[model samples]
Target: MQDRAEATRNAVLHAAAELFSERGYAATSISDISERSGRTSGAIYFHYTNKEQLALALVDAHFSAWPSVIARHDATARPALEKLVGLSFAVARTFRDDVLVRAGARLWTERKSIDIEMPLPFVDWITTVERLLAQARAAGELAAQAEPSRDAPNLVAAFFGLHTLSDVLDDRMLIEDRLANFWLLLLPGLQADPAPRALLARAGGRVTTGHPARVPDGTER
Candidate 1:
């Protein structure tokens, strides 16, 4: 019984997410979710008190998957700057693969007037990036005068722009391509050595075009 109930709940949430993406929150009705999920209106109401609560829940669920991605990158023993670059790629990949994220983006923009508390995932991602920037600064990876909070948002905005482009780009640009390009373009401004010319030269000379290089042993170059 518990399993069945959970399945029903997931179905409703999934259906609602899809519908909410297709139709803005204000335009989507409870009946729309019910019809899409093939569940009765009573079932949806039983799981959620109202559409507003369900919308919040949807946003909550969408963000919940992000921390694990952050954790994986954090566990890597890579340089702080590299970790941040990896995190940006991961976020871009998530936005590409997850329909729920696309829907949530739409919902966020559409309901900007609504007084929904900013989602925790967003807060956490920003905090993580800020922490990384601080770490990079401590390690001499960033310029001495750099400010994490102010600069971190710029990186976040760049990632968001990449995600937005993914929605319209003809041949879905790979996350790595976007990340490498971003790093090439943006890293020079942040780093002391500023390898913009070198990295771009290496990237341009590569045979596979924008494919990330691999060492002779087949590991990522």
Candidate 2:
């Protein structure tokens, strides 16, 4: 019974994510989710008291999704700047493909209309980027002027803007390439020794050429 109930709840949430992504937050309602999920309105209410709660659930899930991704890359022994670059590509793919993430993104953008406050967007993202960049500095992967605290926000902003444009213009068809372009432009100035452009594949992550990872030379970064 517990497992069945969880499945039902997941079905409803998935339906809600689809609707919330296809239709903006204000435009989506409990009824829409019900129809999409083929679940009774009563069942939905049993899992989620109201539309606001449902929306909150999906948005919160999206927020929860990133940490595991970051943790996965961090767990590996790759260079931090490489991790940073790889993280961006991974995120771009998720934002493009994941309906729940799209719903959360829509909810975030249309947060003004939500009666209840959603988690403040971008704060965690900024913190994660800052941490990765700090690791990059410690790894001697960053350029001398690349202050993590100062640069993290700008990188996040650019990433956010790039995706926003991608979402608006073409349902994110070109986003992977566009993001790779972003990395291409930023890498030379950002990395201690930016490697040849092997092209970042958003479907996976950054594709590197055969060049070896940089070792920290005695000179200051």
Candidate 3:
């Protein structure tokens, strides 16, 4: 019974995420999620007290996926410059493929009137990225003057800039192509080594020569 209830809850979240992506948070109705998930509105209410709570839950789920993705590329295993470059590319790929992530990215800037407290999970994700960049600096992956906590926000802004522009440039260059180009251009400022050039080339190849991951169909994973 517990497993079944959990499954139902997940189903509702999955449906809600899809609807929220297609229609912004303010526009998505609880009834839409109910119809999409084949569940009653009362079931959704049982799982989440209200739409605001549901939106926060979706944000939490999306942010939770970042740490595991970052962990996959250990800073210690690779040159710091390479690690930083790899992290950028990995994050771009993750962002482009995940609709919930895309939606959450949109929401982070646009959300209003939620009355939520500090976004602890998001703060933690940013801190972890900063830590990784700091590790890269300590390991001589970055310039001696490099500071991750101070600089990571700029890098994050650059990343979002690329993401935002990718949609506009989709006709001129594929989103993956734009992501590679964006990273290539930004990496030089972060590192003092020439290896970033090669890494950028490899990343471009990975995107242009490979296929983009399909957009996620559901949120259960």
Every model's TM-score: 0.77, 0.87, 0.78
- Per-residue error for 89 in candidate 3, Å, reads 2.1
Clashes of 1: 0
Per-residue CA lDDT of model 3 for 6-56, tens digit only, reads 999989988887888767777789999999999999999999999878888
Check candidate 3 and list the clashing pairs.
none
- Report how far off residue 158 is in candidate 1 (Å): 2.9
CA lDDT of every candidate: 0.72, 0.81, 0.67
Total clashing residue pairs per candidate? 0, 0, 0
Higher lDDT: candidate 1 or 2? 2
The digit string of per-residue lDDT tens for model 2 on 189-212 reads: 787876527424422454543233
Worst 10 residues of 3 by lDDT: 212-221
lDDT of 1 by residue, 6-111 (tens): 9999899889888887777888899999999999999999999888777887777677768898899889887677777767766766766776775677677765
- In model 1, which range of ten residues has the least summed lDDT? 199-208
For model 1, the stretches where C-alpha displacement exceeds 4 angstroms are: 112-122, 143-146, 168-176, 196-221
Candidate number of the best lDDT: 2
